[model samples]
Target: MRRMRVAAAMSVAALALAGCGSSTESTPGAGGASSSAKALKIGMAYDVGGRGDQSFNDAAAAGLDKAKKDLGVETKEATAVNGEPESAREERLQQLIDAGYKDVVAVGFAYAPSVKKVAAANPDAKISLIDSTDATGPNIVNLTFAEQQGSFLVGAAAALKSKTANIGFIGGVNTDLIKKFEAGYTAGAKAVKPAIKIQVKYLTQPPDFSGFGDPAKGKTAAEGMYQQGADVIYAAAGGSGGGLFTAATAAKKMAIGVDSDQALTAPPAARPYVITSMLKKVDVATFDFIKSLTEGKFVAGTKIYDLKANGVGYSTTGGQMDDIKAKLDAYKQQIIDGKIVVPAKP
Candidate 1:
């Protein structure tokens, strides 16, 4: 899906958006959840690794935490197990629904199928499916981010900071979802300096979500790139991203992190090497979705959160990225003005 373009650092005037790529109205969905359901009981189901993945799942957790503090909404959370049956997803969702939750969120691309099935079965429950821009369910509103847009910014940052003019990109699973990350990173780096070398690898192929959780494999993949003269590595490998940080520090190089600001969330030993992070703003989207429901304006459709909406951005913690801010801003403005359109595929 296409998104409305905006300056990467521009402030979003309104947090609640209705349509895809643009913010307007989150209208009450027709067939899914009962928007009028009493007492907001929200639940969120995380992808594998649950709370401590320190990447995607942690970002979503931030949203849930904010909802609890600001909205004072009662909430429940669950995580997936790798070897479980396909029915496992539906069962987790059903358990929450049975436990009196009227609103639930499924985090990750893998949840698209189960969210579709479960949301259809529970027509009166509001469901928010994160990561699938094209996800559609009877009572679900898809909360997706323009990851490519964010990836581009960090890619440019890597180019600016690289001493060897060589960087690497590591993805958890090789899919259209992660491809967006690779595509944007490559495009952004090239835009800054042609002939820059990018080493790309995925932890695993499709049907293997193990990529997101395997730090050992991640370390091996990133270390390979580091040995090849890559000075910076941008990793969108969820928990596996930790290995990228480790390798970067050991090699005396820089690293970029995904989802949350790894410069802050990463372990102290790995923090120094995290030059910056691509922030997905998942927490903002999640809280906004719940806000829509509570406000009686919940809309069910594919909503794309992108640079324009501040849905995707880069972290500036520890002043490590301070030097390259000007260059990053210029490229960001170019993308916003449509002078440069980051590709969704590589």
Candidate 2:
């Protein structure tokens, strides 16, 4: 499984290079009209936890909401269950296309196979893929991110704030993509304090991706880390992050969130313990894709959103990050200028 994920990640990188990092290459539009001329009917296929995950999926939801309000696009949505198969994803997408929703947006790397298969079957449809590069075609736009860069910032935050000089990392799954989070976080923490003790855990292995949705697993993993002396924990586990926040509250420790500002979006009780979040900016990517399609400028290729593009960063909500904001920004600049190269694997 590890080897497969590594190969997949490498494939994405190779494809990005081959595509020349086409950030805004406009292809012939699907409908060839401005948004005002005709309202676009878009279908969103959300990853596990759907719109209320308060982390990854919620960020995607925000983009969909903004597009609906600002561009006047009509939209429908479908959510994936905890243990659904690839065939299910393929069917969900096909259903949307068959229903006349010509522009479809899929919310995770898990949807790549389905996107590719469905895009091939429906040549007239435009499909936007988020967080993956495995799928390719003239009608598909891949929206990916430099997730490790953002994770590095929050990892630094964890190390800086750790009272015990020990931190923890919880990944939703043991995939190469999530490994980027672990790699950046570990690198950042070690850079700040070489002797700091860092513990890592993943909720599930591949082929059982319920880790992204299982709060129980998150809580269990976090509690164990806290028991082992970790004072701060970073979780890249989609909905499972809520469990980490819960564990933080119970243990009187701190937890870092991913993909969205969990300090603001998490439940009120969990807010106080959420020091920061690695903002992945799925919202920006999603909104941009819809806007491009609506404006008759749909593009097919990988668009990598990184720290330089303001597509990924650390959130300072709740004012807990106020003291270290300048330092984080400086590190951000160094990364943007190529002084620091964050690893995509651990």
Candidate 3:
């Protein structure tokens, strides 16, 4: 499954290089639940931690919320459980589609196979997949992000704000996708301070995805890094990031967030330690997917959201990044202008 994800990303890169990163097509009479005569009904399948992770899944939920209010769409949502089998994911999606939900959004790469299988079985269903390009079909739309680019910015922020010049990264899972986060973070930090000391840890390996949802493991990993003289940490560990934030607060250190503006979404007690966040813009992709269906312009292909497309970005909600925003923005523009290339792997 993990290898498939990497290959899928490489395929997406090829598409981008070929000038086919994204394109709209009229799925004539293939609207499924997107009928123009009735309210659009959307079914959202979220990764672990659902709406309150204050990270990835929450970003998806925010899109759903906006669609509800702005588009007046009817919607239903479901979440995956830690360590569940792929069959479970398939069944969850099958249930949503069987219940007359013609438009379904699966919110993580773990659902790639399930989305492919379910969509193939249900020809009338319109499926939007977040975070992976492994699945493709007439009805399936893959929404992927340049997480490395955003992580690079926050990684630069960590290096710039680190008083000890020693920072850390905690990944929820040891996979190619999360490695992109590590790669960009490492490259960005080194770009700023060549001799900086950096520590890295992964909470779990594949088939044991609890790493993405386990706060206790995140806290333990972060505590160890902080004790080893790292003054700032960046967490790409979904719900586990909450634990990292807690650990940062206790250590009187700083931490970076991923997928959302966690300085504004993290638990109140841990907010102060969040210097900045890597914005993945899942909400924007989610809304755009639904909106396109409404406009009869549902695009059926891989869409890569990168620094150039404003799909990924950095957030400075708490003014902690005020001091160095200029430098970070400069780096961001360099990446956009192709003057600096952020690596997708470390």
Candidate 1 wrong stretches, greater than 4 Å: 1-38
> Which lDDT tens digits does candidate 1 get at residues 1-346?
1244454323353332223435223343443444445558898898888887777888889888898778767778999988778799889988999989768988987788888888888899989999884458657898888889899999989988888999999999998989999999998899888999999999998788889888888899999999999999999988889888888778878899898888887879888889899989988999999889879899998888888888999999989878889888888788788888899999
lDDT of 3 by residue, 1-346 (tens): 9999999999998988666423434453365345355888889999877888777888999999999888878788899987688899999999988876779999999899999999999988999999898999999999999999999998889999988999999999999999999999999999999999999999999877888888899999999999999999999988888889999889889989888888887779888889888999999999999999878898798988999989999988889999999999999999999999999999
What lDDT score is found at residue 20 in candidate 3? 46
What total of clashing residue pairs does each candidate reach?
Answer: 2, 0, 0
lDDT of 2 by residue, 70-112 (tens): 9889888999887787899999999998876879999998899
Those runs of model 3 whose alpha carbons end farther than 4 Å from true positions after fitting are: 1-37
- On a 0 to 1 TM-score scale, where does candidate 3 land against the true structure? 0.86
Instruction: Write down the TM-score for model 1.
Output: 0.86
Query: How does model 3 fare in lDDT?
Result: 0.90
Model 1, residue pairs in steric clash? 26-297, 32-139
lDDT against the true structure, each candidate? 0.85, 0.91, 0.90
Q: Give the range of the ten consecutive residues with the poorest summed lDDT in model 3.
A: 20-29
